[model samples]
Target: MLEGDERTGAGPKGALFCPSELRIARGERPSMIGTLDLLGRPAILIDQNGFVAAVNDNASKLFDDDLSVKGRRLFAADAQSRLRLDRLITQVRFLSGKPGRSTLQTVVTRSQRRPIVIDAIVQDWESAGDPLLPDMGALLILTDLNEIPRVSQSSVMEIFGLTPAQARLASLLVEGKSLEEIAFYMNISSGTARNHLKAVFLRTGTRRQAELVSLLSRLL
Candidate 1:
């Protein structure tokens, strides 16, 4: 997490604007390397000056042949991958926070495993208006595509405050099932299934089935 520590080399001025639980105020969003810990994503944040700012728990154990952090800088083992990652970082540093305009993504090919994604996104520092962190700093999210993503029922239930039936439907939808199939599988009437799905959509803040699936797919 982004604690105000000297070892990160981001300097005192570039520490995480949204601090971790170890050090936080009442309203910090805890984004990316800190707040997004709930998504179970592997991510690290870098300051505008190119120093490591913070790392999430999932990202800490990812230091191996594929990727590693050195002297407060992230490094890829392959020369080509490293070059691409550097370019992504440079591009993401200048991104505008206009919803879809905030992130740059690329796939990092690995030798022993399937390709992984490198998603560099602009941090939402401007919202907090903390002078210590720069607005251009980026958070790098690492995802291994080969891993079989399972739907976590508990996570789904908690995220949307769903009932057991609604959570089951949401999980099935994320797993690529149609509402008809889910209804038959769950031994519920088609109308009841649709009602449950509509309620799920309302609670998850999504309007369409596609939107709901897209939102839950991140958990995968």
Candidate 2:
């Protein structure tokens, strides 16, 4: 059994796929939320009863603004965003014991800012207190688009052998900058921005923006 987890057995695995780098070794106390914080992301953990169990340090910045935790429950300031958040929670709360998709994704939009991307992953609390997930029923990983990603453009260029312009474009996309906005910021015409984007796609082997964002986020 995981250290200090004698009360609960290991569940199969949470829906959130933890990379090898994020995993703790045997005999170590695993901190899933802590791992996410190391990468400069926010983690909101909920229990089987649909109550907010815990949140990491990075998550504190989100409170009283884009999101709020009231009565140990998480909520979005926007009505539509709150509805989507509630739906995701319900699905994750009941995801197990039923054959369904292993992962789900949704966007939590802010009133006057870029939307927050959410990935809701379910864990079996009955068998959970394992090292990986502890007592958490579900893990909500949030990527706020309004904030620029911590990834470095030089690293992207070196990893993918992309041109400086292409790497900048990738960084811009992750920053929630639209194509038009990116073109304006870079002082390039829209067509040129499209060309740079296509080049980045070929270099990174990512055909879509979301795919690129997911891949780049892992780099952090």
Candidate 3:
């Protein structure tokens, strides 16, 4: 049995804890909103009823004028964006009631032709809490694929057999970095870093940094 505000129970399959109860336990009243902001990723926190309880600043910026987005339906901002988001929500709900992991990715092009890609992962949040809320929801992460630095497809296909991780590193290289910096962050030696770049250039057929950056930007 639960004791002294300690609510315990089984939740949806994917998430083991109740996000709403967790929020409440953390001092967020049932009516309040909460949010967390992460660098390079936009996130939102929703109430049990699927309302936009809290949204990070990054999410707010996507609305054009950067107005507050709380109290709105989680996907009410744009019709197209809403449709895409609604699918994600449905997936989250399904995964909550069932078992296993799920990930969804979709690209959205605004009316102005600006493109944005969102990658979302749904999982169970388990905790001892109220039975009214589902133990599963979603943790959505947004990335602007258009902003990704690019290299020639041939170069990307050739050098280091670029995995997604390697591609991200290559993109960072276009932003300009010393071998030492890359080595320190990537946990590789300066020699390895040079080798990586050498492979990248050879595959892309670009001899200069400027050329590589310019080429990759267009490709992305």
Instruction: Tell me, by TM-score, which candidate is best.
Output: 2
Candidate 3 lDDT, 116-186, residue by residue in tens: 67665554444324343344355555555445344544555565366554565577776576657877888
Clashes of each: 1, 0, 11
| Residues 23-130 of candidate 2: C-alpha lDDT, one tens digit per residue | 223544237777887877788777755677566667656655567665567767788888887887777677743433356677877877888888877756446445
Stretches of model 3 off by over 4 angstroms after superposition: 1-38, 47-49, 65-71, 76-78, 127-136, 146-220
Best candidate according to lDDT = 1
Candidate 1, position 204, lDDT: 87
lDDT of each: 0.70, 0.69, 0.52
Order the candidates by lDDT, highest first: 1, 2, 3
Off by over 4 Å in 2: 1-30, 96-101, 125-134, 157-220
- Model 3 TM-score, 2 decimals: 0.45
State which candidate, 1 or 2, has the greater TM-score: 2
Model 1 pairs in collision:
30-35
Candidate 3 lowest-lDDT run of ten: 1-10
